[model samples]
Structure formats: structure tokens, C-alpha cells
Target: MGLNIGTITDACQWECVNTGTITDAYQWEFVNTGTITDAYQWEFVNTGTITDACQWEFVNTGHDL
Candidate 1:
């Protein structure tokens, strides 16, 4: 799966679980917390106060062909 964000503000929490890719291109401000859990690959781009606390977890169960 894939995801993108142009602007995120005052977000209390965010969670992402994917087997493909994720991207955030633009601005994230005043975000309280966030989490990303991927099995393959992901990307985060752009700037601004993303969050006060952010967590990322990656788990590889197998190989990608």
C-alpha cells in the first residue's frame, strides 16, 4: 500500500501498517504522536514540526521478489 500527506496538524496519533510503501510530502505541524510499521519499505519527505513523539517499527517476515 501507499500513503501521502500534504499537511498534517494537531494530530493526536497516526499509525501505518504496510507491505509496500508510504510517503508524506509537505508539512506536518503540531503533531502529538505517530507510528509507522512496515514490512517492506517506506519514505517520509518534507518538513515542519512533525511531532512531539513519533515511533516506527519494521518487521520482515519474508523476502520480496
Candidate 2:
């Protein structure tokens, strides 16, 4: 089946990145738009609080988490 865009929200404090790790604080409080996993913690939106166009280019490519 085709997977659609999904959203994610971490209960604990976390920062979304392209990959995940023990050192990677589990604070990925983000809206998972697709196949996001524990290894994908380096794809966080580091654009600060300036919500606007081009603010969603923080995927860091298809790199491993």
C-alpha cells in the first residue's frame, strides 16, 4: 500500500534530525511528514521561528539516521 504523509510528536524533549542515536537527545518534537524513524533524527527544521516559504528544506537529504 502507498504510505501517506504522517505526523509525529515526541513525549519527551527532543530535536528532529536525519538520524537518531544514544547521544542524540530524544527530543524530536516534529510533525512526521512521511517515513520518519528513530534513525532519522538529523532532519529537524533548524529554521528557527520564522515560519515562511523555503522553511521546509531541512530534510538533510536521504541520509541515514
Candidate 3:
């Protein structure tokens, strides 16, 4: 089975679990592939102006999935 989020439009929350044999899924990400939005974008303080800054890097090499 699979989950298809192709029809979702509004804000919502969802979760997924792995039942396959990928036991070493120790890394995941929340990559924003869209334009700079307020709720999910990073900014810096320069001249009191906020703009789209560099993306944050996250990694967990020692944790198990």
C-alpha cells in the first residue's frame, strides 16, 4: 500500500511508518522545494530586513529509524 498526497491542498498533518526491509534508514529531511514562504523559511537580520537565507542542514548518522 501507498499514500497519495496529490489531492491535498490545505494545511494538514500526516505521518508514515516503514514496514519494509530498509532497516538502516537513519537519515531523513524536510526539504522545502517551493518558493520562500514565511512559515517554513529561514532569514537573517540585516538592516532589519528579512529575506530568504541559506537552507539549514540536518543529519543524524547515529540514530535508528
User: Which candidate number has the best TM-score?
Assistant: 2
User: Order of candidates by lDDT, top first?
Assistant: 2, 1, 3
Instruction: Name the candidate, 1 or 2, with the larger TM-score value.
Output: 2
Q: Model 3 over residues 1-65: C-alpha lDDT tens digits? A: 22322222221222223344433222212233333223322221122212211222222233222
**Model 1 lDDT, residue 59, Cα:** 27
Per-candidate TM-scores read 0.22, 0.25, 0.21
Clashing pairs in 1: none
Candidate 3's displacement at residue 21, Å, is 1.2
* Model 3 TM: 0.21
Which one wins by lDDT: 1 or 3? 1
- C-alpha RMSD of each candidate structure in angstroms: 13.1, 10.7, 15.5
Name the top lDDT candidate: 2
**Residue 64 deviation, candidate 3, in Å?**
33
**C-alpha lDDT score of every prediction, in listed order:** 0.31, 0.35, 0.26
Cα RMSD for candidate 1? 13.1
**Residue by residue across 1-65, what tens digits does model 1's lDDT show?**
22423222222343433332333322322221345343233233323332322343222324431
Q: In order, how many clashes per candidate?
A: 0, 19, 0
